[model samples]
Target: MKRQRAFFHTLRLPRFRRITLPLLLLLVFTATSYSLVGRQTATVPLPGLVMIDAGHGGYDPGVMSNGILEKDITLAIAKQLQAALQARGIPTAMTRDSDIDYADSGTKGSSSKRSDLNKRLELTEIQQATVFVSLHINNSTLATRGGAEVFYSEQNEGTAELAAAVQSELHKIPQMSKRDAKPGKYYLLRNQEIPSLIVECGYLNIADERARLNTADYQKKLAEAIANGLDSWLQKNK
Candidate 1:
């Protein structure tokens, strides 16, 4: 009887030791992992919402040349831009998703245009956007003049930086013309309280540019470049 009791006691101690050691190790590992995860989460910055405005729609076709309508092109590029930004975890809102304008009922001529623009401006505040980007297609009498240009309002301190960032990325495109970001007295940019800029994707009067802008592939490239530029600016400013 004494021998049997001693044998059982020896086995019990070994079993207890084995279970207790592993449990303690597990607790330590779990605590370490949580600490690392917390640190990573705290270091990452949150991005702000961007307001994208497709320049013209509905009755307002903006500048048209070479069988291309400005309203159509703007909406296409805007949608692509929204997708690209969202894919990178950036929040975005569009002024108009369809071929429609914001003008109120019975509004006509210049009044309609003003009403439409005012409504678009109101969205920036409504969406609580940190930045505003207006997409447009340029037209010049000289057919030779082509390429994307970025314009910013001098009223806002950060507008120039945002424009420069986007302009730099657009310049990297093989088919895009290299142009410096400039200040503009545009209605949208002038009234914006936040950082606002207009990106003239390309000249519609230019044959080659018009053809490329009409294609889905080129529009995607433009959207991607704009997205990269916005991402770059956000990272630095955030």
Candidate 2:
């Protein structure tokens, strides 16, 4: 009883009011986060073939919110994801590395969207990707809604499985909720012969989400989650 009372007394310092509470909260959260990550890491399957597509490049801006361009965010997250996967010895491919709209010298790419898509479509011939993932930011008529969503092309069963893996990984994050995978007709998913999924990271229409999407830290987290999902799929499927 005396020892317990002394422990309480130590926490009674004035500094405890300002620092102890926050510190204790941080410790609790950090432990919880670490525990969750360990669980996800164990569950993720690192499949052999992984391909990444940054949606709406070059002539297309994709979605816009508060003037934040979806193309920019997609590319940033895509690159970060690539690094994360590569670090784990997972092979991956990206459709385009530079801004599609302009050349390296800042000259315009294809003037027409149709022509631009035609060029993007040329990527299909490169190689048969085991799984194709198109990265995109979401847009909505309502400004209050936001969250990550995964969609698979109806043409392939593998796509559905891959989407589920990704959705599960995203849910491991602190604020992200588990969104169910659904069927969709995104051309990248439908046209590609390989299993493919499209990830709508978050709705940009919501001001808070848009700001979050624009930050590098959030982008890093997005990549990590994606890599985790793909890794999860690969570990089990391959």
Cα RMSD, each candidate: 19.8, 18.5
Residue 184, candidate 2: C-alpha displacement in angstroms: 0.4
Off by over 4 Å in 2: 1-47, 101-115
Given candidate 1, what's the lDDT at residue 143? 50
Candidate 1, pairs of clashing residues: none
How much RMSD separates candidate 1 from the native structure? 19.8
Best by lDDT: 1
Residues 87-170, candidate 1, lDDT per residue (tens digit)?
Answer: 777777787777878777787898888988988887567555778999999998865768899999998877788889999999
Candidate 2 lDDT over residue span 1-238, tens digit each: 1111000000011111234678768655654211221221111222364667777775578888778999999989988987887776676666666566322223244434444444444443342356778889989886466789899988876767788888888887666645788999765666767777889999888777788899999889888988888877777776
Task: Please name the candidate that would achieve the greatest TM-score relative to the true structure.
Answer: 1
Candidate 2 global TM-score? 0.72
